[model samples]
Target: MRYRALLAFLAAIVAGLMVVSLLVGPAGVGPVAGIAALVDGKGALGLVMREIRLPRALLGAMVGGALGVSGAAMQGFLRNPLAEPGLIGISSSSALGAVIALQSGFAAVSVLALPGAALAGAVVAVALILMLAGPRGPSLTLILAGVAISALAGSFTSLVLNLSPNPFAVTEIVFWMLGSLSDRSMQHVAMAAPFMAVGALLLAPLGRGLDALTLGEDAAEAMGVRLTRLRLMLVLGTAALVGSAVAVAGAIGFVGLVVPHILRPFVGARPSRLLAASALGGAAMLLSADIAVRIIAPERDLKLGVLTAIIGAPFFLHLIWRTRGQIA
Candidate 1:
């Protein structure tokens, strides 16, 4: 009952935030004007609201929701609540791919190019991890592989920036890594929506498997879950969702790691319930962050990712401190 109510409240809040994102800009547009323009058409306020802020707001919700659900699924699959897209290097690889494409000057022709390369990079990282883990390797091996991939991708990104001729490329790369929803457009939405959709579809059904996984691989296998196939589905889905998010939005952290855990209690630790609840919570968190990013600057918009880091970093540190003993 609470879960359903909370979701409803979040939906209402998201709707309100969308309204605020549309109107609460430095341009002095109000919701009334924005909506009027949207409905009536042929107004400057309407166009800017429709073209700029609306797409960004929607993308923030979409990407944030995908990350949240993906994170929950990962944590379930790994039996580790701390697992996140970044920890496994998917985001880094995605960012590297985006950087390569952007630096190649394809981004100049179309912003969508980077996202494609990022997806490619994400798939590569997942493939490498799977190959390293093999069919029967332990979970720990897969984690180690992910860590190595992250380090490699990060170093390669730095090296690429250093080698790039365009001075602007370095700054751009840094900002992109920081994560931001600012200035995002329909092109980015187009690049990411299909992938994110696919990810959601993959993950929503894994709730039962997640429950089985909490009892360990052998236990899950005993419960009729095919361990290898389940793991493959999780890895591939997470890669597609997260890869596309990084491709479109860069590396927005904490949404995955934070949302599920925060809402775990509300849903009573059931992985399936947590999945849907966190999806809503994550959407709210990101959309709210987008609102914050726009209003806080109103003029000098910071990246949505930056704000999330500022907010998530402390939470993350506390989590690390809390879990250090456990991980060790």
Candidate 2:
């Protein structure tokens, strides 16, 4: 009952935020007219609501939900509360791929080049992680390998930016690395939606496996929770989710890391329940953050990633302080 109530509450918050998100843009559409325009699809108001704010709101929700769920799944699989989607290097690698595409001038040829390169980078990163950590390796091993991969990927991304001939391209790298949802179109929604949907399908059913794994690997295996399959699903699903998200919005941080941490206590720390909760919470947090960026700096182009980092980094320090004993 509590779980249901919590989920319902989060859902309500997300819904409210989505409505606000759609209505809060510079178009000056009221709640009633904005919603009406969404369905009516006739006038300039309709076009702005449907085309501009709608895609931004939808992508914000999707990206936030993906990051949140992926973070929960990662934490559950590793049995570490600190585990997040980026901990596996997938986000960095995807960013690297997008950076490369942007730098190489291929992105000019096709709209698909950026995201395609990002997805490819995610795949390669996953392959490398699996190779370095081994299929059956422990969580610490995976984390260490992921850190190395993330560092390497970050370096390559920096190199790409440094080597770009277009001075403007160097400036664009901040948007790619920090993430933003500005000027996003329905085409981006179309490109990323399928991958995000598929990844959600893969991750949603793993609650039982994560719960079992909480009892330890041997216990989980004895209980018939195929560790190999679970691991594969986690890697691939996270890759798909994070890859698609970074491809579309760049590398918005903290939603994945912070949302789960905030919602975990409410869900009794069950990975599966936490997944759903985090999804909603993440959506709310990001929508709120997006709204904040626009409100706080309507004139300056504030990066979504920058705002999240400001909020998350302090929280991260607090988290570390709380867990210092464990780390030591």
Candidate 3:
């Protein structure tokens, strides 16, 4: 009953935020008029509500949910509270792909090129991670492989940025790298939603496996939890989630890391319960951040990723401070 009530409360918060997200734009539409315009779909207000705010709100929720659940699964699998979705290099690799697309003018050629390239990069990184980790490798191996891939991808992205001759392209790349939901359309929602749904499906059944994993691998294996299968599903699902999110929204940081950490205590530190709660918490966090950016600097195009980093970096430091004794 308690868990259900918690979920219900989080869901209510998410729904309320979604509504606030739709209403809190530069246009300053009232709640009733904006919602009515959304339903009617007839005039300029309808277009603004449907095309601009709706997709931004939806993507904010989807991206936050994906990052939240991915972070929860990684931390659960690794038995490390510091584990994050980007720890596996998917986000970096996706960013690298988007950079390549922009540098090569492929992104300008078509609406889908950037996302397609980003997805391709994520697939390649996943393949590399799996290959390097091997099917039966331990968690340490996965961590090392992911670190290596992230380093390599980051270097490549820097190289592209350094060599690019087009100033306009450089500005676009920089802005995209910073991440934002401004000017996004329904096409992005259509592109990313299916992949996020697939990732959700893969991650949904992981509650039991993750719970069993808390008992250590040998014990978990003895109890019918297939460690190999669990790792594989986790990698694939996280890749899909992070890949699709980065493809559309660029690399928004610390969401996966912060959301799960904040909600874990509320869920009694159970990986199983943390999954759903973190998803909802993440949506609320991102939506709130998005709204904050709009309100704090309505005229200045504040980047969502920058705002999240500002919020998350200090929390990260605080977490490290608290865990310093454990680290030593």
Candidate 4:
């Protein structure tokens, strides 16, 4: 009952935030009218509501949920609270791909090019990381490998941006790296949703294995939890989730990192419960952040990734300070 109640509360929050997201845009559509427009498809208001805000809200929820669940899975698998999707370098690689597409002028030619490139980059990065870490490797080894891959990807991305002849392309690269949901269309939803959904499905069933893993690797192995299979699922699932997110909205960081950590205590450190709670909590957080960016700077463009980093970095520093002994 407690667990259900918690989930219900989170769901209610996400639902309310979704409505708020729909109504909070620069279009000036009232909540009631937006709801009506979404349902009836009546006129200009309907067009704006359905075409613009609806996709944004839906994508926000989906992207947030993806990051949240992915983060939870990573933390559980690694037995580290600080584990996040970006730690594996998939997000940076995806951003690099998008930057290349922008610099090459391919993104201008086709709306799909940017996302396609991002997805490809994520796949390649994950493949290389897996190769470097090897199957059934130590978690520490994987983390170190991921750090190397991320640094390499970031360097390449910077090189591309610096070498671009078009100054406008450089600006686009900055925005893409920072992330946003503005001007997103149904096309992006179509491209990212399936991959994210697949990733979710793959990660969702691993809760039991993760919980058993809490008993340590030998115990988990004795209990029939295949570590190699678990690692495969975690890597592939995280790649899909992070890749699809970067493909659609660029790189919104800290979500997967923050949401699971916040919800872990409430879920009693159970990986299973934390998964769902983190998803809902993540959705709510992203929706709230998206709304705040619009309200705080109605005239200026504020990137979603920038806002999240601003909030997450301080929290992360505090976490590090609190765990200084562990690091030492």
TM-score of 3: 0.97
Q: Would you list the C-alpha lDDT of every candidate in the order shown? A: 0.82, 0.88, 0.91, 0.89
Residues 1-328, candidate 3, lDDT per residue (tens digit)? 8888999999999899999999998887999999999999979999999999999999999888888899999999999888999998999999999999999999988788899999999999999998999978889999999999999999999899899999898899999999888888899999999899999889888998899888988888899998898899899999999999999889999999988887876888889998888888888888888888999999999999999999988988887788689678
Residue-level lDDT tens digits of model 2 in 1-328: 9999999999999999998888887667778877898999889988998889999999989999999999999999998876889999999999999888888777787878888888889989999999998888677788999999999999988787777788888877766678898888888899999999999999999999999988999999999998888888888899899989999889988889888888887998898899899888888988988988888997787989899899888987888788689669
| Candidate 4 C-alpha lDDT tens digits along 1-328 | 8889999999999999999888987778776777999999789988888888888998899889988999999999888888998899999999999998888888887778899999999999989988999987888888998899999999998898778888888888998888898888888899999999899988888999999989888899899999889988989999999899989989998999999988887888898889889989888888888888899897798999999889888987887787689668
Among all windows of ten consecutive residues in candidate 1, which has the lowest summed lDDT? 22-31
The TM-scores of all predictions, comma-separated, are 0.93, 0.94, 0.97, 0.95
Worst 10 residues of 2 by lDDT: 25-34
Kindly report which residue stretches of model 3 are placed more than 4 angstroms away from their true locations once superposed.
Answer: 319-328
lDDT of 3 at 29: 96
Candidate 1 total steric clashes: 0
TM-score, structure 2 vs. true: 0.94
Better model by TM-score, 3 or 4? 3
Q: Which has the greatest TM-score?
A: 3
Q: Judge candidate 1 against the unseen true structure and give its global Cα lDDT, from 0 to 1.
A: 0.82
